[model samples]
Target: MGGIVPMRDAGRTGTLPATSDELSRLLTVVRRGRVLTVTGRFREPRSRLVREIARRLSSNFCDGAAVVAIGRPFGVRELTAALGCVPGMPFLPYGTADAVSWLAERDMLLVLDGAEHLAPEALAWLRRLLTAAPGLRILASGRSPLAFEGERVHRL
Candidate 1:
């Protein structure tokens, strides 16, 4: 949609090419839900497709969109670092509280691409983020769902 967004690669997996119908469905779900997972094996085109969706729909969000490429061994630290990269966020020290506070006031689309594997603590962190940031919407691409209270999964 724009310039190449830098991506962090997880271990390689097959590509699942995206179709316009799939894109439309995903977009619809994102608009209605707080969190969505495009579930597929690692290294598929899920991240690319999610980024495209973010680009297309970011304008609907007040603070716009940020796509974070989640790499292997995903954890709270990585999550915090990724969130810090969102435009205008202060330089955040590695901590969950900082992230939660910062995002609490913003409206944005946060796309976590390549989140196929998340440890329990990381999941907890995401839960806290969702609970605190009322205006934040997450579109994640992974092999499995985050299983939050209102998560919507689109299996690829």
Candidate 2:
């Protein structure tokens, strides 16, 4: 709760607290779905909300997590390590297939920040990951939708 930083929208005439009860309710909705994408024109503020949600979920037995930025490909290995998984268990996965397999059966929260710039194809792994790991939940933020089937898109 404390880690969340409110956003200043200079684009508008007034600034608003980016993190609000509305965002909390949004998190509740996101929690209900296996996959969720938070979209907004204000990328920074939206991403801040996503990060806050992830922070709230971090202590809920999350095994892996990352705020994947634009221009960055898959970095699930670093997330896995952040979750306390041993580094280089066998090999680092650079692709989604291997990343999914690497995260098989793990109950984790993976955050994808700046998702709008991410190629839609890059998220093909989400469907499989959701199906394979029942305990996994993805929280993404971007201007556009991830377009994954069953993905709940919340726009701010």
On TM-score, the candidate that comes out on top is: 1
Cα displacement (angstroms), candidate 1, residue 145, comes to 1.2
Runs of candidate 2 with Cα error greater than 4 angstroms are: 1-19, 71-91, 94-96
lDDT of 1 at 1: 14
The residue pairs that clash in candidate 2, if any, are none
TM-score of 1: 0.81
| Model 1 bad stretches (over 4 Å) | 1-16
Clashes of 1: 0
**Consecutive 10-residue window with the lowest summed lDDT within model 1:** 1-10
- RMSD for all candidates, in order, please: 4.9, 6.9
lDDT of candidate 1 vs native? 0.74
Angstrom error at residue 102, model 2 = 1.6
lDDT string, candidate 2, 1-156, tens digits: 111121222123333335577767776866677778888888667766777677666656455344444434443443333323222234435655666776676666667676655444546556667778788787887788888877888778
Error of 2 at 44 (Å): 1.0
Candidate 2 local Cα displacement, residue 5, angstroms: 15
